[model samples]
Target chain A: EAGVTQFPSHSVIEKGQTVTLRCDPISGHDNLYWYRRVMGKEIKFLLHFVKESKQDESGMPNNRFLAERTGGTYSTLKVQPAELEDSGVYFCASSQVGLFRPTYGYTFGSGTRLTVV
Target chain B: QQQVKQSPQSLIVQKGGISIINCAYENTAFDYFPWYQQFPGKGPALLIAIRPDVSEKKEGRFTISFNKSAKQFSLHIMDSQPGDSATYFCAASIGGKLIFGQGTELSVKP
Candidate 1:
């Protein structure tokens, strides 16, 4: 089976511009998550979608960032008026129905490297 | 608050030696603990994982020692090799939401 896939592996945008990153999860996976790692920092969770419904969005940094998973298949994270701090690698991961079951580990996409200049 | 805390921002180990990385978590509700390995410019891949119910789990040369009471866990790499060098991240999850620790960059010298 194909693993999670991300679009536009690298993106460069000017400050105050907008950017959207996309992720396609593995087939039959019900849970999708968004995470990003800033320069010299650990990866941080942004939000999670269980199908078409968002399970938790507490990790979203600010109002400028938005994530959606319509139809619970693919997910998109949009950054409006992107700031320099938004420049980083955005990763998307997916897991099967079970919650952290050993049989299925979260499969992550290669990630999108975003640069805000 | 950072739920998970990992130590040794970086480590250099000689080949065939033992490499140990430690992590502590504040949330007792976290039942699933997983370790992820990431190479430069690549997304993290699942290395090994252990549940709070088990004290230790071993897979080949990689072992995870989980301490539920102390809320601490660790990853041990035996007979370390250059191929094992990467950034390792420890994460905990409850209800499917994961909280990750600061990653540990490991370098194995040949």
Candidate 2:
């Protein structure tokens, strides 16, 4: 089976522009999550999806960031009016649910490096 | 509010030596601990993990020593090789969400 996959491995855009990142989770996985790491910073959670509904979104940095999972499949994270501080790597991860704390571990994509100039 | 803290921003170990990285967590509710390894230009991958019920877990040349009482854990690489160089992160899980520590960059020189 294939691992989690992310598109546009690297994206470069101007400040105030918009960029959309896509993630395809593993097959039959109902749990997907988004995380970001600014330069010289630890990876921080952005949001989480349990199928089509959001399980948690407390980690979203601001109103400019929006995430959606359609049909309980792939997910997209959009950054609108991107700021210089938005330059970083975005990673998507997935794991199965109904386990005892997801012990099987999460499979992460290679991540998309977003550079806002 | 960083829930997890890792030590030694960077480390240099000679090949065939032992490499150790330490992490401490502040959340008592966290029951699952995992270590992630990331190569350049790649997302972090799960290296190994341990639950509070176990004090130690080992896989191949990698080992995780978990101390639930002190709320701390560490990754140990025995007979480290140059290919083992990478950035490592320690994370604690509440439910299924992970709280990651600041990463430690390890370099095993040949």
**TM-score of the second chain for every model:** 0.97, 0.96
Model 2 CAPRI quality:
medium
> Could you tell me how far off, in angstroms, the CA of residue B51 lies in candidate 1 after the best superposition?
0.7
- Worst-scoring 10-residue span by lDDT in model 2 chain A: A96-105
List runs of model 1 lying over 4 Å from the truth. none
**C-alpha RMSD between model 1 and the true structure:** 1.1
Tell me the spans in candidate 2 whose CA falls farther than 4 Å from its real position: A100-105
Would you estimate the TM-scores of all the predictions?
Answer: 0.96, 0.97
lDDT of 1 by residue, A20-76 (tens): 999999999999999999977878899988898988998899999999898889999
lDDT of 2 by residue, B17-73 (tens): 999999998788887888999999888999998888999999999999998888889
**Docking category for candidate 1?**
medium
User: TM-score of model 2 relative to the true fold?
Assistant: 0.97
